[model samples]
Target: MSRDQLVTLAQALRELGGAVPEPVPSGAREDSSFSGGRARKISVSMPEDLSAAVQQRVGRGEFSKYVTEAVAQRLESDLLAELVGLLDEEHGEVPEDLVAEAEGAWPDVE
Candidate 1:
């Protein structure tokens, strides 16, 4: 992917509350987060155009990796949303001023 595409992807992931991947801490395996299970094959249905688009972006050898990463991203995003919803339910609505302040502090973020 182009640098701009990568940046856009990262931004979208962040907006969905995906945690950015960081270096493994000392004594931890680099793939510890994803290494437990044997790889499995699965089939999915998608629009013809969407499937074509994915294929264009990824080579045949990398298609599985691309799909795996996409699925992981969505799962993390859903988990983050769920946690935020739980927090909101417990704490009630956040104050407008605090929201505004947060936006102001990170003006570049959408």
Candidate 2:
């Protein structure tokens, strides 16, 4: 499988409480305030089966952390998709050679 597919599978496994490697931070953004601030309670309704599955996987009293991680992952995916769509609209599809060049240069530091 491709690296992207593997990554998606790993994230799914994490959300389901399966053993997986800890994710490395992307380094694109850092917001420490969220971690230090108070957390407000929010209610959400889901299908009974999904709720049951989540409860079974994460157990009681841990739903908050599970939901927080799930929401953060989903929001990251949504933002990335939106950014890609906007870039495609503004610049058309990126060229293959340019993509290769960027990939080649990515590993080296000045």
Candidate 3:
């Protein structure tokens, strides 16, 4: 995504009471090897209260990592939704009975 779009998303998350990390410097490179990809640094705007809350929970050093994970999850969810839409368009919606059966078969985790 473009930097401006990321900034806008961060701001929206902040407005919704979500924590967003301060931007990493242009010179810094995030080691995203753990996730099998390279990471890019970009600027983001977030509220001080949310920032403080995140720091309290994960500490200042992990702020960026925390936000990265949250954004990743959101993106994955968006992709899944898009996939579902495509599937529904190609082959009508899944039967409610099948959905109910799938839900019942899904493992419940504590």
Candidate 4:
């Protein structure tokens, strides 16, 4: 990133009450490997019956990719539900401070 962009981002983060000067990771391949890049290997696990079923339906060659994607989608959905519950607990239907800021704030909004 450019120097000006970095400065602006750090200032925005500070406005949100977080510490500045976090360590930036370097010397790693961080760019997207999308255009004609080599594929990488990944591993996953499943129950014996489920694994057998996937192998039967898609075969070992393509089974890993499909199962990995399914598992990732499931994990994302589970995490979202959990985070929403946590926010509800911390802030109620809406944060009281936010509600008290402006009158008639949420009229007919919800």
Candidate 5:
């Protein structure tokens, strides 16, 4: 991604109160051979209240795993949103009936 895209993504993550990871250096290979189950240690900052709430739910020992899962989900959501935007640009907006049919097929959970 371009530096501008990286900056935009970092800003979006910060807006969501997520710990934005360090950006990859320019010209670096974007993909790594690291396995999904492998872990890397990195420091991150978050609000005290949010930290406390997460700790209260998952306890300190499981904090890293919890954060990892949350970040992964957020990235997936962002990618899906981007794909939708691309589709909209190419094909115009989705029809309301089609959207309603999709909603009926996969209704939102409480």
Candidate 6:
């Protein structure tokens, strides 16, 4: 990986309070014991402000490791959120009367 990409990855890991990773063996393929599923792509928008932040870490000759780490983190975060919503009592749907009572009396979604 490029030097710029390596720095980028380190920042991403640090931001997430994770350890930086070691390089894979020279001939080993990227392991995916936890890969989500068959891959597909979709686009999402990011605020312009984030670009400068990303670029600052991925500047010329900088490590670009942050790209992979960031993507993995984002995917993991989204998956965990989905799982939590499904499994957590507070996050998913509620009975109609309970919802109304909470909404009217407590003014809170939960």
Off by over 4 Å in 1: 1-37
Q: Residue 31 of candidate 1: its Cα lDDT?
A: 35
Off by over 4 Å in 5: 1-35, 107-110
Candidate 3 C-alpha lDDT tens digits along 1-110 = 43335455556555544555643333222432124335666898899999889989997688778887677567645544555565576679999999888888885932
lDDT of each: 0.59, 0.60, 0.61, 0.50, 0.61, 0.48
| Deviation from native of the Cα of residue 100 in model 2, angstroms | 6.9
lDDT tens digits, residues 1-110, model 4? 33334445555545555455542223212232111223355565668998888889987677655654565355445444555555566556666777776546757665
lDDT of 2: 0.60
Give TM-scores for every candidate, taking all chains together and pairing residue i with residue i: 0.64, 0.56, 0.63, 0.42, 0.61, 0.32
Model 2: lDDT of residue 103:
81
Q: Kindly give the number of clashing pairs for every candidate.
A: 0, 0, 0, 0, 0, 15
What candidate 2 gets wrong by more than 4 Å, as runs, is: 1-34, 97-110
Error of 3 at 106 (Å): 1.8
lDDT of 5 at 27: 29
Q: How accurate is candidate 5 locally (lDDT)?
A: 0.61
The 10 consecutive residues of candidate 5 with the worst lDDT sum are 27-36
lDDT of 2 by residue, 22-66 (tens): 443342122321142446566898999998999999898877777
Candidate 3 collision pairs: none
Backbone clashes in candidate 3 total: 0
Task: Please report, as a residue range, the 10-residue window in candidate 3 with the lowest summed lDDT.
Answer: 25-34
- Candidate 2, clashing residue pairs? none
Q: Candidate 5: deviation at residue 29, Å?
A: 21
The candidates, ranked best first by TM-score, are 1, 3, 5, 2, 4, 6
